[model samples]
Target chain A: MKDPMIDIRNLSVTFNRGRKPVKAVNGVSLSVNSGEVVALLGESGSGKSVTMRSLLRLHPKGTSIEGSMRVAGNDVTELSARELADYRGATVSMVFQEPRLALDPVYTLGQQIEEAIMRHENVSRREAALRALGLFEKVRIPSPERRLMNYPHEMSGGMLQRSMIAMAIACNPKVLLADEPTTALDATVQIQILLLIRELQKEYGLSVIFVTHDIGVAAEVADRIAVMYAGRIVEEGKVADVIQNPKHPYTRGLLGARVELAHGRDRLITIPGAPPDLAALPPGCAFAPRCAEAAAQCITDVPRLTAIDDTASVACVRYA
Target chain B: MINLVGEPSPILPVGERGGPAQPLISVRGLLKHFPVKGSGFLKPKKVVHAVDGVDFDILKGETLGVVGESGCGKSTTARLLMQLITPDRGEILFDGESAGETLPLSEYRRQVQMVFQDSYASLNPRLTIEESIAFAPRVHGVPAAKAIARAHDLLHRVGLEPVRFAGRYPHELSGGQRQRVNIARALALEPRLVILDEAVSALDKSVEAQVLNLLLDLKRDFGLTYLFISHDLNVVRFMCERVMVMYLGKVAEIGERDAIFEKTRHPYSSALLASMPKMNPGERTLEPPLSGDPPNPIDPPAGCRFHTRCSFAEDVCRQTLPPLSRISGAQSAACLMAMTNSGHSRAPVQMEA
Candidate 1:
């Protein structure tokens, strides 16, 4: 509890390309202690996924990352190719949005999972196979033994996601990074997956960084939420505190526009315009264009994230 | 033929042709079964029961929401209504006139339009926003100049300024903008019944709210009825006046939005409602309301398709397929417990109470 398991400090990632580089992650600093789950909430182009992907050092060549990213006591940016390979699945694992694309179609699910296990540790094929079945049962895959032989195409979306979860925890990873795991599934099935992830996170006492765009989902899963807007963290707080009394104007707009919250109202109180383009975002606050409370200062000077209390922070001129 | 009364009071099936309270579109025993591949040559032909024995009434000037899992045939039902696919059996009556028989197919089609989920694929890349909207109207005997004029008018109505967006191609616009253009195109023919199949499911939170409000305005101004299909329960509840819950191509429950959302009768409906993420962090869902994926639709469970997953399912539920019958004032459910005499051991006792 003294030090966070995953600490990202003053990180800035830029895509090195034509003319000006695309600044994807700008001065993002977040920390997750052991067994704590923090949801990085943002709409598209907000760079939530990019920040999570940085922990694994998965960015393409020519991309430059500044500042420190420490996961499981290892400096992620300084890790070599061989060290990164060993650190990835054993120390931290990821559950991607689309399991169909994340999983290999050519091999059986059993083969893929067993291969990952054996690569991480010195285990025999038979032992790895047994461990795979155990992981499958933990994730509640029906008829685990038979399902192990089925290809990725044979399973439903929810089933495939369960298999993905099973594979993710195959190595007993310390941290699990889930990027929109339940976005594609049906509502009935989505709840099941969310519950399973929560249950697994508890049983394993794993630190988690869940990236999602849906606020309801963030509330349901994460202990803390970091709201991102145009490559910047606009607000960070406990899920209840942020939801009950949102500090930032953008977070307030998000909660107000939720259809469930607008139950009795005839017309939804929508934020006027769309999210700003990340590549060519204007100066000052990116959300100032659509923010109802954007003052004259909000249009000229960018607001820094200022802490309001022990568990809450907001990045707006009014709060700053 | 618009119903001036916005309230969706249950208009029971009009047994005769010229009943006073005729529904805009009435579907009876709608069935469509797609055969599984490589099932031939002396083998028993396997069929995926995409839609079977479904019946509903889309009331005039009201949004009827259809919700289900991916393979529950919600989209199949919409396609059947649009004549995009031919059904194996059943009949669809438009204003008491048998569709394609008394009422010409083209005339029936002209009054109905559909907006799909993928905003980009629905429109052509080469055509500008004005041309895409004008194409549909031009196809139905409208002159070139008049169709283009109508298109510009529709773009303005859908909140896209014609002066700025009329000439832009589909690729040049954002996802929200493309969806607005698609909505404009759907309204170009002045469609009376618009089927929105996950239309706002792709947009962001703020954009979805804006589009939903726009949809309400259009519906009120045009006096249009909507058959809205979606997987998101929250969005469905907000947009729809009446809601229908389908499970494996069968109507588990259908009723007024309040009754379905509040006084839910079917086990499946309750499970679905419970699964919606409560927007508050204080009251987080402890247990998953339902577990396991939907059973294979190719060979659905015997009798009641939902019995395998239903918590209160009994032997009788496994043996007998319960009929969808009205239980409350405006709510109907196709569950053994809801059927007063459905011999599910607990039905009669509950019914008496």
Candidate 2:
């Protein structure tokens, strides 16, 4: 098989290392092959965003990261400051949730896209501007020329997100990191954006690590889904298998809780308790307190991500 | 405007006291327009038609879900029902009396409470959870001690133990907990109708489910009516008995949940339903149901508000506004195609095929 475009091994990231540290991501290992889409599904504070940000090394200065992250054949953890700057946006790019906040308010989208291109590539200003227009057209933004001159705020939320996607793929990165890109968009516009991302990913053969809390969206776009609970990946499998036959209690609860258009269930099955506090997580399984299938052993021993079948792996004492 | 001294009082009898079986709240021809600031003093100021010619009825003890994209005036309609903003035109009839005419604004507001999307912003940081919930009742002339006791009961009802959480400030709670507190506060007034404006949108799926179940239980126990406004179609479908779909400050469709979801007639409603990302990976959306955003509210299309992005737009659709017409039992849509069956068939059948 071809080498994985992005390989993360035993990745652990903690904030405020010495005093009152928060282990945001604990022992997460993920691999994304070229042209594949892996979704990291979790609620707030489940370390889905933190795990993705580690790929770009975008965490705050005090964050202590202990992990092996190799993206596009480069050790992300060992990159120097100069190399790191070059790595971002060129090797790996990200599309954030709120494009209005991510984009520069003062600059026209054209200048920003041109800047991104000129910063990384040895292209003239005019050539970069031309490329930016082409990128806009590629993303199917209407009137690409006029849209290029428009400021971010002038465009609607969906349009701004499309421009953001256009900017993210300007450098033709190998791996794309999208953190809830469609969460802020309206429903009709959200489908357009999701389809655009999927189309661009296939066109470029980019490995995508899409992070979202919506299982429906993950199912729509992801090839594989990794369910995270309290900073740990409790389940990882092909989207169909995970949705059809979920092994982990948390995954099952999430599926049951999902409000589907087809199903008219009276009450959604809720996971009893909130996610554990990362700073003071419970020993053993982080989800044990909320897991209905949790046993006495679940409280005392951490469950490793063991392969349940050729297509799936689950980190649960029940599975063990 | 002369009044006779012997005229009977304008106030209608309260809550099914010998009155006909009328909806609890009825809105007709509601319109709210805000003037935009022009570049210069001489430039003709444009107007943003935030809520333009919207009409609906909310029966007592029924949950009516309003689903629409942002800027579709769903929030504006909610605020209008709460009487937080005055309408430019149209009347709001509450309990068989025109609100602000026979019925006073204060009484209208008392009967209709609102819970906003941002729980943190809606709550006071300095106030404890109990104090926040108790504030409304206390101001409405309930005794302090009784209000406090009621707040404690409400907190317990929302699954946050009053003994542990009552004394804690808003900042001390998580997003879901803060939202529960917000819900409790909305219920403090014993309102007949509660406007939930994206209340669960900010919560996680698990917590959202818990809150939705709690809301259902509260609705049943208290006999409360709800105006559930959200962009999440699934949640709206699950929580609402009846649903209203809006497009650019106008009612696109309104009907029973099953009628709206299963046999939708409006092109816009069908497109919106088709746009929902499917849970099955094997079934992908073949095409984007609708392209581009809704047209700017300031300069909405002359005919159908949705024609700009609608795939079934015909020449007539761009020239003449379509009045909402009933398609089947309790299901109504304001689409030229659905009304006449002339252009393309409704968006759902076309998309499915």
Winning candidate number (lDDT) = 1
In candidate 2, which residue pairs clash?
none
- Over the stretch A226-259, how does candidate 2's per-residue lDDT look in tens digits? 9998888999999999988898998888887877
Count of residue pairs whose backbone atoms collide, per candidate: 0, 0
lDDT of 1 by residue, B1-353 (tens): 88798888655332223444678889999999999888965888999999989999988778999998899999999999998999999999887888788888888787779999999999999999899999987889999999999998999998989999999999999999999999989888777789999999999888999999999999988878899999999988888999999999899999999999998989999998899887787888988888999988899999899999888989998899999998987999998887767787778654455
Clash count, predicted structure 2: 0
Task: Please state the CAPRI-style docking class of candidate 2.
Answer: medium
Q: Report every candidate's CA lDDT.
A: 0.91, 0.90
List chain B TM-scores, each candidate: 0.92, 0.91
Stretches of candidate 1 exceeding 4 Å from the true structure: A16-20, B1-20, B349-353
Q: Which 10-residue window in model 1 chain B sums to the lowest lDDT?
A: B11-20
Q: DockQ of all candidates, in order?
A: 0.77, 0.68
